[model samples]
Target: MRKLFSIIGLFVSCLLAAQEEEWRVIPSVREWLEEINNWPDSVYRQDNLHVFFDYEKDTGLIATTFEETDSLPSEPLFIVNKPVRVSGLNFAGDRKGPGTMPRRLTSIQFNGWLTISRMAQNRAGFVGCVFKDDMSMWDIQSRNVLQFVDCDFEKSLHLYGPQENMGFYIANTSIKEDLIITSGNTDAGIRILNSDLSQFFVNGKFTQFRMDSTNVRYGMRLSNVTISNSFQLQNTSLPALELIGTDFPELHTYIPFHNIENALALDLPIGWDRDQDLVKYKAESKEEIMDTQRFDNLIASYYTLLEVYKSRGELTSYNACYIEMRDKVTARSKLLYNQDPSFTNFFAYQINRFTRAFSDYGTRPEKAIIVFFQVVLAFSIFYFFFPSSWNTTNNRTMMRRLSYLGSYFTSKEGLSDLFEKEAKEDYKDYEEFHQFISSSEKRLPIYFQWLSKPLYRVSVSRFNLSRRLLASGDILKGEWDQLPKAKQVRTSILIGLYLVIYLIYVLIIRCLNAITLSLNAFSTLGFGEIPTRGLARYVTIIQGFVGWFLLSIFLVSLIGQILN
Candidate 1:
C-alpha cells in the first residue's frame, strides 16, 4: 500500500514539472517599435481600434506621439483599441460585468518586437493601457526597444514575449517568455506586471538593462548589461540583479541590493538591508522562559504520574469513577470550576478534554510504543521517502530562500545556543535576527525548535525508563542475582523495544503540535487558511503515518527473513 502511494506521489510531481510552460523572450527596444509600426491594426476586432488612432475624428483616443498636450494627454504614442480579438482570444478595454465597468483594456501579441521613442511630452515617455485581462503570448516578442516611458498597468497582468527575438515594444503588453530589454538610449524602461497594479513580473529572463528605481515585487535580473557608467537604481520594494554575461567574469559583480529603498550599484555596508520597509515583524518574545518550561514540565510530570498510577492499578477506582462522571457530564471534564463565574464556554470545555488527554498520552510509554511501531512501518515501505523532519524543514527552507536568507543553526546544540542568545538580546534585534536566520536557514522557527526538542524529550524518556526499571521486581532481581545470560539478554531486548516505541509516540505528538503552529504562522504570510491547514495539513499527516507504518513493516519483515 505504501509503495503504491510513493509511486503516485512521484508521478504527480513529474506531471506538474512537465506541464509548466517556459516564459517567452522579449526583444530589444529598437526592433520592438518597428515591429509595432508594422502590426496589422487592420486586424481590429471592433471599431474601437480606429477610434483610438484616427486623428481626423475628435474622439477621446487617437494621438500622434507619446505626449499629454492639450490635444493629447497620455504618452507612449501607440495605444491598443479596446475589445480587440486576437488568435481566438477576447480582450475588452472596458471590464463590463453587470454594473461593474472597468476603466479600459489593452492588448498585445507576443510574436514580435516593439519600440517607442520621441514622445510629445514627459521626456521619460510612457506606454500603457488598462487591461481587463492579461496580455497574450504573441504580443511580447515582436519588439526590440520597449519602454514604459511613463505608464502604469492597472489589473492583474502577465507578459508573454516571443519564442525568439522579433523586436518590438511590449509595454502595457504581456510577454510570453523572458523580459529582455536591449536598449542603447537612456530612458524609462518596461514594467511588465499584473493589471491589478500589485507587482512587476519578468516571467523568464532579464537581460541587458538599466533602471533608476523599480519595485519588481517578485524579482529582477539584468544579463549582459554594462553597469559602470549606467548605475541600476532599486527602490525599497523589490530585489534587484546585475546580470553580467557568464562569459564576462569581470562584469559579474552580482551584489544584491542591501538597501531595501536603494539598489544603486555601489559598495554598501552589511547592515543596510535592515533599514528597508520590510513588514515590521516584531515577534513577541517570551519573558518567562523558566516559567514556561516549568508549566510544561509540571503538566508532563502530572500526566506521567497518572500513567504510573494506572499501570500500578492504584487509580483504577478513581479512573472508573472519573470516566463515568466524564461520560455523564462534558465527556472529559468531571471536575470543572470557575472562580466568580457561573457558566463556562461549552465548546472550550469539550476541546480541553482532548487537549488534556493528548497531553497526558504524550508523556506515557504508550505514546512511544505507537510512534516506534510507526517508524518501523515506514522503514518497511517499498518506496523511498524523506525523514519525518525533512518535509517541515524543507517547506520552511523554501520560503526563507524566496525571502533571500539562510539559517544560523541546523543542530540541536546550535539551536539551543541561538534561543539562549535570542532570549537575552534586544527585542528589535532579536526579531530581525530571527527573521534573518529563518530566511537564511531556509527553515521555520518550528523546525529549529524541533531540532532541539529531542534533547529535552530524551530527559523525559530517561527518567521514565529509570522509574519503570526500578518498579519492575523481576528486572531488579535479574540485575542483583547475576541471572542467566539468556534471561538478561531477553530483558535488554524488551527494554530496547520499549524505548523505541515510546520515542516514536512522543515524536508523532510533537509533529502534531508543529502542524498546528505552522498553520497559524502561514496565515501571517498571506496564504488562505484553507490551503495552509485543511487539505494540505491532513494530507501531510496521513502521508507521515503511512510512511512510518510501511517502514516499520519492512524492517520487521527483513529481520524475520534474516532470522529464518
Candidate 2:
C-alpha cells in the first residue's frame, strides 16, 4: 500500500509537468474573465485590468476573441510570463453599439500567429512578442497610441488604412518579410526605432515621421507620402530608396554614403499614370505629354536635398545629387527636343550632354582639366604625324618675336625703333664679351688668371653646344657642314655619332613643337602668329572655340566654389 501511494504521487507530478508544457486555451470570454478574476489580488489589478502571469509556473495560455459572437472583456491587459500563442484575437471597436465604452488592450504579449482586424477607437500596445506567422492589421483607428516594442515578426507585417492616431511607435523590432503601411494618417507622428526590416513601403499623410537606427535589407518606397512636419532619419541603412510624389516640409537625415546603396530617385515622374504601360507608349505621343508641374517638383525636390546636404557639409552626397539633377534636366531637354524638333531645343539638349560628359555638369573641375588635356594631346598627336599641316618657322624667329612682345609690354623705354636698336646693341656686346671670355684664354694676366678661369668656366657652362644644337636645326646642320672634308673622313665615326644624336634631338624637338602649337591653339592666347594652314587652320579655330567655352565653365565653377 505504501509503494502504490508513492507511485500515484509520482504519476500526478508527471501529468502536471506535461500540462504545463501544453497551452491552456480559454475557449470564450467568460472563461478568460473567470480565470483572471480568481487570480490573487497581488497579481491582478482591478483599475487597469492588469493581470501578471506567474513566471515560476511557466504556464502557456491561449486566448481567443471571436469577432462574430464573443467580445473581449473591456480594457483587458494580457501579459504573458512565458511564450504563449494567441489566435483569432479580433477587436471591432467600430462595431460597438452607441454609448458603449471602447476597449483598450495594453501590454499584450502576442507570442505566435497574430492577426488583428477592424481595430478601432481604442489603444493597443504589444511588447516583447515573437510572431511566428504573417501578421496584419487593417482599418486601425485609435485615439491613444498604438505601439509595438521589442517584437519580431518572422513573416510579413502589413498595416492598412490606419487613420487619425495619436502616434504609432515601433522600436527594436525585426521583420523578416516586407513591412508595408498604406494610407496611414496620424495626428502626433510615427516613429520607428532600432528596427531591422526587409522591404518597407509607406504611403501616408502624417504630422511627422521619424526613423532611427533601422536597417532595411531590401528596397524602400514612399509613394504619395505627405508630411506636414519634419521627416527625420538617423543612422538608418536604406539600400534602395524610391520617392515618388513624396512631399515634406523638412528632411533631417544623418545617413552615411555606404548606408545608401542606390542614388535617391528624386527624378521619378510624378504626374504620369503609374498603372499604365508607359514603356509601350512613344514619348512623342500626345498621351505622353510632359507635365511641367512634375518637372518643377522634381527640380524643387533636388534643390531642397542639395541645400540640406550642403548645410550638413556632406559634399559627396551634394555632388551626387547635383549630378543627378543635371542629368534630369538634360533628360527633360531631350524630351522637349523630341516633341518640338526645333533648333533651340536640339541645341539645349546637345549642350547639356556635352557639359555632362566634359565636366560632370561642372561639379568636378578636375574632369574639365582632364578632358582639356585629352583634347590637347589628341591634337598634338595628329599634328605630329602630319607635319605639313602646320608651319615650322625658324626657332630663332619665334624666340625673337616672343622677346619683342615681352619687351614691348615691360620696357621702361617706349616701343620705338630706337629702343629696339639699343636692345640689339646691348645683346651684341654681351655676345662678344661671352665669346672672348669663353674662347680667348691668353688675354688674361697671370695675377687675374683665377677670376678669368672661373668666368670662362661659367661662360662655357652657360652656352653648351648640345643645348644650342637641340634648340635649332639650322645651327646643328651648319656645324656639321662646317667640318673640314679631310678631317671628316678621319673622324667618320664621330660624324656618324653626331648624325645619330642630331636625329634623336630633332625628333624630340619636333614633338615638343607639336605640343606647343596645340597648347597655343587650345588657349587661344595668340602669343604669336598662327602656325597652321589650310584645313588645319580651321581645325585650330574650332579647337580655340571649344577651349574658350570649357575654360569659361571651369572659371565659373572655380569662382563659385571660392565664393561658397
Candidate 3:
C-alpha cells in the first residue's frame, strides 16, 4: 500500500512541474496583482524576471491600467515578486526578432504617472514593451535591477528614489523626455545602448552612465562623470556641458567643457553664404550684444531653459532657445573681439580666416608655408628690380636695366665669364660636364650610381651656361661705352680680382649659407656678415629696413596660426 502511494505522489509532482512551466494567459490587471502577490520564494529568482511563461499566450500579453478616479496609494501599479524577462517587447505585433518568437505587441498603458517600485531581490524587466505615458520608479531596493530592451517610453522617466547598488540596462529604446535622477545611487550604474534621449542628468553625482551609439539632443549636464570607476559614453554625439569634474572618458564629439574659455576653435563664415563682394563681411548677424556681466547671467539662464525645454521633448521650443542662445553668444564674442584694440583678437580672426578657410578651425600648416613662400617671392621681385646704383655715373638715377625676360635664364657667374676674357655665346665646358654624367651612368654599376648622386646634384646645381650667355648678352647690349679693345683690357684686370673673391665667397657660402647671411640681412638682428665690395651694402641696408616691417607682421601671423 505504501509503494503504490509513493509512485502516485511522484507522478503528481511531475505533472505539477509541467504545469508551472506552461505559458498561462494573463487576465485583467487585478488578476495579475493577485497572481504574483503570493508567489513562492523558489518560483521568483532575484535579479531575474521569468515572465515568458508567466503570461498565458505569446500573441497578446498586455498590462491593464487603473482609472484616474481610483485613489491608490503611491504603491507601484504591479508588485511583482516573480522573475520577469525583457524577452517579448514587439512593436510590429508579429514578434519577429532575434531571441524572440512570433508574438503580438506587448502594450502597457497607465492612467497618468506610472510607478514601478521594486524592493528586496525582486527586479522588473520589460522587453518589446511600450509605455503610453510617463514612467517613474518610486524606490528601487539594493541589488535590484530594472532593464528594458526594444521599449518605447512615450514620455519622461524619473529614477530618483532608487537605493544603492541598483542597476539598469536600456537599449534600442527612445525616451521622449528626460532620463532624470534627482538622488539615490551610491556605486550604482546605468547602461544605455543605441538609444535616444533629449537630456540626461544625475543631480551632480557620480553614478556612471555608460552608453554607446546613443544620441542626446541637449547632452548631459552631470558634475562628475569621470569620478565613476567605469564611465563610458563611446561613439555618442552628446556634448559635455559640465565644465568642472566631468568628461566623456571615452569616444565623444565637440570640444570639452574645460576648453570653452579659449576662443571657439572655429572660424565663422563672413555671412551665411560665400560672396565675391566684401560687403558680406560687414553684415552683422545680430544687431546688438549685451554687456559682459548681463550676457553671462543671461546665458546661464538661457542654457537652463534650453536644457529644460529639451528634456520636455519640446522640439520647437528647444530649437528656439538654442538658436537664440547661439546668436547671443556669437554677437557677444564679436563684441569682445572688436572692443579690444590688442592685436590679439584681430589677427586671431584674420589669420585663421585664411589658414583655416573661415569655416572649420582645423589647422593647415601647409597654407601657412605657402603664404610664407608667396611673401618671399614678392621680396625676391623687389630685389630683382632694385637698382645696381653705383655702376652708373649718376648713382641716384641708376636703374637696374636688365630685361625681366632675360633674368629668367641668367646668373652673375656666366655674365662675368662672357664680359671679361671668355667672351662666347656657347659654353663647351658646361656641355662636356652634362654629357659626362649622361654617358657615365649607363656603364656604371648600381653601387656606382649611388655614389654618383652627390656628383649629379653638384652637376645640376650649376647654372646652364647657354642661358647665362643669352642673359649676359642682354646685360651688355645697350651702351655707347663700346671701346671694346681698351674696355676689354680694363675689364680683364677687374675680372681677375673679382673671380678670386667670388670663388672664395662661393666656397665659404655653401648653398645653405642663406640661413646665416640671408637671415642676418633679413632682420634687425645685428649679427652681420661682410659682403665683398659691390651693390651688396646698399642692398643690405634697404633689405634690413623693409624686412623689419614684413618680419614683424609675419611673426604676429605665425603666432596666431600656432595658437589658433
Candidate 4:
C-alpha cells in the first residue's frame, strides 16, 4: 500500500510539471466582475472577450466592462491565471448615454505589460470605438486623451487611465516617465505621455498612422523614423525631425520632432532631384574596371613626375604636386562614394579603406618602398609607347568647370537666373552631358600619352648623355645649367637636358596617379598592386636615371684621359 501511494505521488508531480495555465472567456460584464472579485492576488491571463464597455453599472472601479445585454448570466465571472494572447479584440457594440457619456471606459489600466504585437492587423474594419478611458494621473497630465479619440486610434492607441490599474500598463512603474505604447509592425510605433499637462512624446512609423495636421493634436508630437512616405505638413512645430537617405526634397516627406538643445543632422538637397542627378553623375563617371587599370597608370606617370620635381626642390613644383595628389586622392574617393550622406562621403570611404590597408602590411619602410616601386614599373610599361596619355590639364579643367556649375545652383538669387537658362534646354536631357564626362574619362590615356612623349626623349638622352656629364671633370654644378657656348653649338644637347628633367617630373606624377587610382578602383588590392605598377612605371622613370649614371661614368673616363 505504501509503494502504491509513492507511485501515485510521482505521477501527480509529473502531471503538474507538464500543465499549462488556461485562458477564461467572459461574455458578460457581470461575469467578468465575479471572476475579478474572487481572483487570487497572483497573476492571471484573460482572453476571448467579444466586447468590453466602461459603464457605471454599480462598481466604482471595475477592471473590465461592456454595454447592457439580454440573456446574461445571473452572476457570472471568470478568472484566468496564465500568460494569454488573444487572437482578436473587437469593441463594435454601442451603448446609450449622455452626449458627454464616455462611449468607452474612461479609465482603463494594467498592472503588468500589455504588449500589442501587431496593431495594424488588430485594427482592421473597426470604427467609432472608444480606444481608451483614462482618469489615471498619467492620463490627466498627458493632455493627449482627446488626441487618442480624434486621431486614428485604431492604428496605434495607448490610452492611459488610472495609475493603479495593472492589466494594460506594461511599463516599469518605478520609471518616472509616461506609459509606453510599443507597436511591432514593419513600422515600429510608439505613443508615450507620462503625467497630466505633460507633452505627448510620439515616435516610430508615422506612415502607419497617416496622422496629418487635420487629425493630430497640438500636444502630440512625433520624431525619429527609419523611413517615411508621408509629406511634412506646413506650420507644424516638431522640433525633433530628421530625414535619412539621400536628399529627395520634392517628394512627400515629414520631419521628426527634436528637442531644442539636441541638434539633428538635417539633409537639404544641394542639387535638384538630387538622387536621380547623383545616379546620372555616378553613371557618367563610372569607368569600366578594365579602363581604370589604364587610368591608374596615367596617374602613376604624373606621380613619378611629381617626385622628380620634389627631388629638384622646386616649391612651385611641390605645390603643383600637392594639388595633383589631392586630385588623385579625390578621384579615388569617388569610386566608393557611398560612405556618408554628404559630398565627402565617397572620398572619405576610399581614404579610409586605403588607410586601413596602409596601416597593415605597409607599416615598414622597405615594404612601402617595394610597393611604390612596383607600381611605377607596371604603369611605365603600360604607357611606355603612349607617354603623352598622362596629361591632366583637361581633367583638372573639367572638374573645375563642374564645380562652377554646382556653385551656379547654390543660391536662391541665382537659382532663378540659372533655371531660366536651364529651362531653355531640357534639364532632363542628360545624354550630351553624360557623353562629355564619359569621353573625358575614356580620354584619360590620351593625356598621359602626350605627357609621356617628351618624357621618352628625355629618358633616352639621360641614359646616354647625362651619365657621361656627371662622370666628367668638366661636368659639375655648372652642368646642371646649360652652357652659353652650347647655346651656339649643342642646341640639340641643351634640349636633351630639358627633356631629362621634364621626363623625370612627368614620370613621378604618373607613378603617383597610377597607384592612387588603382587603390580607388580595387580597394584593398590597390596597396597590394602598388609594387606591381610602381615597379613597371619606375622602369621608365628610372631609365632616365640609368642614363644619367651612364653619362656620368663616360664623362669621368673622358676627363681622366684629358687630365693624364
Candidate 5:
C-alpha cells in the first residue's frame, strides 16, 4: 500500500512540475484559508499549517478566514475550500511542544463542524490533526476529493451530493463517533480504508459504500448500505457491534450512541464520551480506581460484543464474551460495596454468576450429565454404609420356628402328656420291630442281615443331608431331646447368590458393571433382570427417584433453549 501511495506521489510531483509553479507560503491559518477561498488550483503543504499553529500568540484559537481578529474566540471553526495540507496542531489548551510527549496530541475544538466548499481541480486533506466535533463536505461545488489521514475526530462526519465523481478517502484516522453519509439519490462511492470507526449509519440511498481494513468500534446499524445499488464492507471489525459486511439488521436504538471505545483509546477521563466535544480529559492522579468508570465502560462495550457474537452464530466467542462480562460484573459490583471483592461480594449480586455456572443458568442442558454422575456416586456411598434389612434370611427361619411353637402350644393335651403319648408309640414300634427282626433273622440267613447294617446307616445319613438342602430351618438327625441344636446361620437371600459367583469386593458386584448400573439407575431404567437384591435393590430404588428429578431439570433447560 505504501508503494502504491509512493507511485501516486511521484505522478503528482511530475504533473505539478510540468505545470507552472505558483508555490507560496502563508503567515497564519487565517491567511491559508483566504488563499484557498480565492484560488482552488494551487498546491499546499502540511508544514505550512504546522508553521501557522506554532505562532504562540494564537496557540489555541481558530478562525474561518472571514474574521481578522488575533484574539480569543468562541471556539475553533475552520473552512477548507481549496487544496490544502496540514498536520500536528492544537487550536486549544496548553499542550506540549513538538515530540515533547509523542503520540499524545492536543485537540482543535470545532464547536460544531468543519465547513467545506471547494471548486474543480482542487482537493483538501488534513493529516495527523485533530477535529473536535464533526467534518462535513456537504457544500463542495466542484470535482475535488477531500481526504483525511492519520487524524482524529471527537464525533462523526457526513458527505453528500456529487460525492461519486470526487470520492473521499479517509485513511488511518480515529473517529470517536459514527460516520453517517446521506447517499440517497446519489452515486457517491465512499471508501474508508484502514481506520477505526465507532459505528456507521448510511442513510437514504447511494451507489456505493466501501470500507476495508478498518476497525469499527461498535458494529454498524443499517437496513442496507445502499438503495438498490452498491454497498460493500470487508476486512473490517465491528469490535463492539460485530457486524460484518453489509449484513446489518434493521436496528432500533433503545439508547443513544456513545463512542466508549474511542474514549478508552484516547484514555480520556471517565464519562468523557458523554458529550461529543473535543476536550482534553483531566483528573487527579490519586483518585481511587474504583471511582473511575473506564472499567464499566469496557463491560458495556463487551456486552455489545456479546450481542455481535450471538447474531453471528459464534457460540465459542459468545461464551468468551459471557465469561468476560461475568468477571467484569464481579469487579464492578464490588465497587458498589467495597474494593475487596473476595470479602465484600460474598452474598452480593455477583454471586449469582456462580450459581449460573453451576447450573449453567439454564443454558447448558449437558450439565445434567454431571448431576447424573454426582447422584449415582452419592447413593452408592449411602448404600455402602447402610446394610439393608431385607437381605437377611434369618428372619424367615425365625418366623418358621415361631409358627411351630404356636402349633404345639395350641394342642389339646399338655406338654407332658404329649411327650408320654409319643414315647409310648415309639416304644411299641421298637418292640414290634425287635420281635419282627428276631423272627426274620431266625427264619432268614444271618449273613444277609449283618451285611445290610452298613447300607442302612449310609441311607440314613444321605437322607439327613438331602433334608438340610431343601429345608429353611436346621436339620435334626435324631430326637430333639437327645442332641443339642446347631446354631442358625445368617445370610443374604438373593444377594448371597449373585455375590458368591459374581461379586468379590461387594461394590457393584463387578467393577466394570458399576458404570452400567449407575447409568441405568440415573436414567430410571431399572432392568430388574440383573439380580439386584438386598442393599443394591434399595439403592436402585433411591436412584430412580433422584434420577427422575434430575432429568426433569434437564428437560426444562432443553425446552427453554428450543423455545428461545
Candidate 6:
C-alpha cells in the first residue's frame, strides 16, 4: 500500500512541475519576428516596429539562442501592455550544440509592466520601461553590462545576488517604491545617474559604486557593503542615509557634495541613551543584551564622513561631523560607565564632555579662545568686587586723613595747628618739577589731544594737587587754621576737591591692577610678580592650571587646522 501511495505522489508532483513549465515556454527569435510582422498597422508601425505582447493573452517570453539569426533586429523592442509575471526569463546566451559560442543580446526596450522572479543573463539593456507592479530578479548572473534607462518602477524593485564582473548602469530612471539590491560581488561596479529613488538599499561587494545627480527621497541604507576601489556621490541629495559596516577605500576624495541643495542627513543607527535604556530593560525583563556593534559602526561612519568633509575643505561640515563623533563617543563611554561603574569609563566620559564643550573635540580652536575669554571675564568680575590684599594697595591712611579734615571742618574748633603740621609734613615732598616730568613721560601725542584731552586734564590736575595745595605756605599755618568760618569753609572746599580727585585716581588704578591680575592668571603669562595671597593665591593657581590646559588644547587645534 505504501509503495502505491509513493508512486501516486510522484506522478502528482511531476504533473505539477510540467504544468508550471508549460506557461514559461518562450518563443524563439524567428517566431518573435513573425509575430511582429503579423501585427496590425494600428498596433505596429514602421518607425517603431516593436512587438506588443498582451499579458492576459500572449505568452510574455522571448528566449534567445546561441545561433546568430539574420532576421533579429539590431535593437529588439518589446512592449507589455498589462502586468506580466514570469517564473524565469532566460535572456542569457544559451548553448545550442557542442563548440557553439553563446549569442549576446545587445539592447532591448520594454514599454510597460513586466515582472520576473529570476533572470539568467547575458548583456541586457532596458529602456523606457514602466513597471507597474513589484519586480523581483533573484540571483542574476550577467556576463556583461546590465543597463536601465528612462524607466519607471511604480512598486518595489529587488535585484539580488549578482555574480562577478556584472556591471549595472541606471540613468534617468524613477523608482517610486523601494529599490533593494542585496548580496552581490560585481567587479565592474554599479553606476546610478540622474535618477530619483525612494528607499534605496544596497548590500554587496563591488569594485566601485557611484551615484551622480540623483535624489533619494525617503532613505538609503548600505549595510555590510564593501567597495574596494571607490564610492562616490556627486551632486546627489540623500535626505536620510544610514551606512552600516560599509567600507569605501576612496571615501576621502570621492564623496563630493558641491551641488546638493539639501543637507546630507546622516542617520545614526542607535540613540545616544539607547544603552542606558537597554540596561534598565534587561534588569526588569532579563532580555538579551543589545549588541554594541551598531554603535561601533556608527562611530566609524562618522569618522569616514569627517575625513571626507575635511579632505574637501568643508570646514563647517567637518566640525559638525567631528562634534557628532565626539558626542557618540561620550555616549558610548557613558554606557560603559553604567555597565561597570569603573573609574576609567567615568573619566573618559567626563573628558569627552569637556572637550566637546570647550573645543568641539578640538576641531574649532576659536571656541577655546572664546571660552578662555569667558573664563577670564568671569574671574575678572569676581576679583573686581572682592579684590585680594596683594593686588590692592593700603589707602586707609589717606582715607582717614580725608575723614579727619571733613570732621575738623564740621567741628566748632574747625582745625588745629597739629593737624596743619601733619598735613604739611605729608605734602612737603610733593614737587612741581616731578609732576611735569611724569606728565610728559605718560602724555599722549598732541595730534591725539582731541580724543584724550578730557582724560589728560583729569590726570594732570590730580597729579598737581599737592603742588597747588602747598603753593602758598600760609594755607596750612596756625593763623589759617584759626580763620573765620567763611575762610575755613573755602579752605575745606579746596581740600575736598583734592580728596575726591585722588580717590578717583586710586580707584582707577585699583581697577586696572585687578584686570592685570586676572589676565595674568588666566593666560598663565606671569609677566611679573604675582602678589596674590591666601585664598586668592589658590584661585589664581587653579586659573593658571585651567589656562595651561585650555591653551594647550587651543594650540593643538590650531596646529591641526594649519596642517589640514
Winner by lDDT? 6
Residue 520 lDDT (model 3): 56
Global lDDT scores for all candidate models = 0.34, 0.60, 0.47, 0.35, 0.49, 0.61
TM-score ranking, best first:
6, 2, 3, 5, 4, 1
What C-alpha RMSD separates each model from the true structure? 35.3, 17.3, 18.4, 28.7, 19.5, 13.2
- List the candidates' TM-scores in order: 0.24, 0.55, 0.45, 0.24, 0.38, 0.58
Better of 1 and 2 by lDDT: 2
Q: Write the per-residue lDDT of candidate 1 for residues 441-514, one digit (tens) a residue.
A: 64556777666446545644554455455444334232312547787577567655755775566556545544
Error of 6 at 18 (Å): 22
**lDDT per residue (tens digit) for residues 184-209 in model 5:** 45555567899987766555444455
Candidate 3 displacement at residue 2 in angstroms: 59
lDDT comparison, 4 vs 5, better candidate = 5
Q: What lDDT is reached at residue 198 by model 4?
A: 16
Worst 10 residues of 1 by lDDT: 116-125
Which sections of candidate 2 miss by over 4 Å? 1-128, 132-150, 154-172, 176-198, 203-218, 223-251, 255-301, 335-340, 385-498, 531-536, 560-564
RMSD of 2: 17.3
TM-score-superior candidate, 4 or 5: 5
Top candidate by TM-score: 6
lDDT, candidate 3, 1-564, per-residue tens = 999999999999999987754543343333443454455652422222223322334323332212211332233333334433221111121123332322222333333345545432334455555565667665565354556666677677777656666677788889876677644436566788999876566653444666778887544555433334445546675433332234332322222222222211111221121123212111133332434454454466455444544444544444444444555555555566787856777665455344233212222334444554454455444443432222221223222222321332243333544433332323455457557756887887878767666665564445444446556544334331343767646655564565477555543443224334445556567644554236656766766776675555556545644543
lDDT of 6 by residue, 1-564 (tens): 999999999999999988656533333543443444455542322221122232222222222231323243433355434344444555422233222223333223333344454455555555555566666666565556666666677766777777557777888889877777776545657789999986677888877788888887666777788888777888876655666677777443465443332222344232123223211111111122224554555556677676667766777766666665666567667677888888898889888888888888888888898998888887777676656665444467566767666555555423443345455544443445345545775575765545555655665565456445454432434344567888878876776687788878777767777777888898888746557666777788888898898888889889987876
lDDT of 5: 0.49
TM-score of 3: 0.45
